[model samples]
Target: MDVRFQTGSKRFNYRAAGILIEQDHVLLHKQVDDKYWALPGGRVKLGEQARDTVVREMKEELGYEVHVDHTPWIAENFFHYDGHDYHELGFYCTLISNQSYFQKGPYHGLEGERLIYQWIPINELNEIVVQPEFLTAGLRRVPEHTEHVIVEN
Candidate 1:
């Protein structure tokens, strides 16, 4: 099972996210009508590799197949949301797509409250809320090798 827990009223999760970039832009998932935006991925299933998790999440969230070159980033995130505390360990991977990937806004994604795909210019990423926050910098100045990050919000 996915790693999760509860402490009093807090909830924690372990997830994997993708960092698909094209033309200096990155794909993001947004909850329509909500002030939240995140990477295009989800929880890593039990016994699933984090890299595979990103691939599976892409298909589930975008209905397209993708390949991962490498897992370039890992995050240990902590935050508070809607009345509960959360701690999420996330894997941020790079995607290599043979098919044309979305490079614009409003691409329909996984079923939810208008959960859609969006491509944000890396330069203008400061305009939205990207969980972990560190991605904001990492994407702009991508490291030569994988980097581990810890985020507490």
Candidate 2:
């Protein structure tokens, strides 16, 4: 995510993310530059619904078609990084696949040069550095007693 910031000012960059949980694990995209992982969603396109963004992002990033369940709006987060501020929404979704779906590919041809997919325990999230919003927002979508939290905020 390329963000520009003004000196001594915070600018909110609008973005969206998705939380994919299965069993006690959550699906995350591991970026190359860092070991930290993130949920499988991206910034919302103009005129696009947040739900649609999750579905589309899954296809583009993971090459799997997904079904977005329930109305989005679990987490809304604001943070500053890389000299800029961000305002993001995290949505919860389910993966729909005709066959076992794993691996990364069919990437939208940008920002995913070394992306890899993995299912990680939710409780272990704190061991790594991730987008805080994704963790906060993602947890709300899962069952209250779930061992793993899906946070997008």
Candidate 3:
């Protein structure tokens, strides 16, 4: 099962996200009704490695097979959403794929229109709302070494 649980009024999650950048653009996705976007990934399943999670999620969500290039960050994200206080541990991994289909334009993911995927120009990230805030600047300059980021929102 996915690594998520609730205790009292707070919920905790362990997620793995992939950062796919190509041709000066970065891939981002969100639920059609949501106002914000985030890297494409999902909760890590039990007994799964983070890298494996990235590869699995990409194929499952985007229909593209990908390999993990490297891990850049392990983020401790805190926030409130849908009335629950959340404590999330996120593994942010850089990804590489041979498929060029996503480079064309915005497309609906395998989940139909509920999830929307788009390649946004990296330079224009300032115009859109990317969650975890740190990623707005972090994606512009990915650190050579893995970083431990604590984001409380």
What's the TM-score of every candidate structure? 0.91, 0.65, 0.96
Best prediction by TM-score = 3
How far out, in Å, is residue 128 in model 3? 0.8
Order the candidates by lDDT, highest first.
3, 1, 2
Candidate 2 structure quality by residue, lDDT tens digits, 30-54: 6666646667777677677767877
TM-score of 2: 0.65
**Candidate models: Cα lDDT each:** 0.82, 0.58, 0.91
Q: Candidate 1, TM-score vs. the true structure?
A: 0.91
Candidate 3 per-residue lDDT over residues 1-153, each given as its tens digit: 999999988999999999999888999998888989999999999999989999998998878888998999999999998899999999999998777645667789887799889999899999999988899999999987899999999
Q: Candidate 1, residues 63-132: lDDT per residue as tens digits?
A: 7789988877888888988799888888888888888785655777656557867889999888877767
Candidate 2: residue 132 lDDT (0-100)? 58
User: For residue 58, what is the lDDT in candidate 3?
Assistant: 90
lDDT of 1 at 6: 87
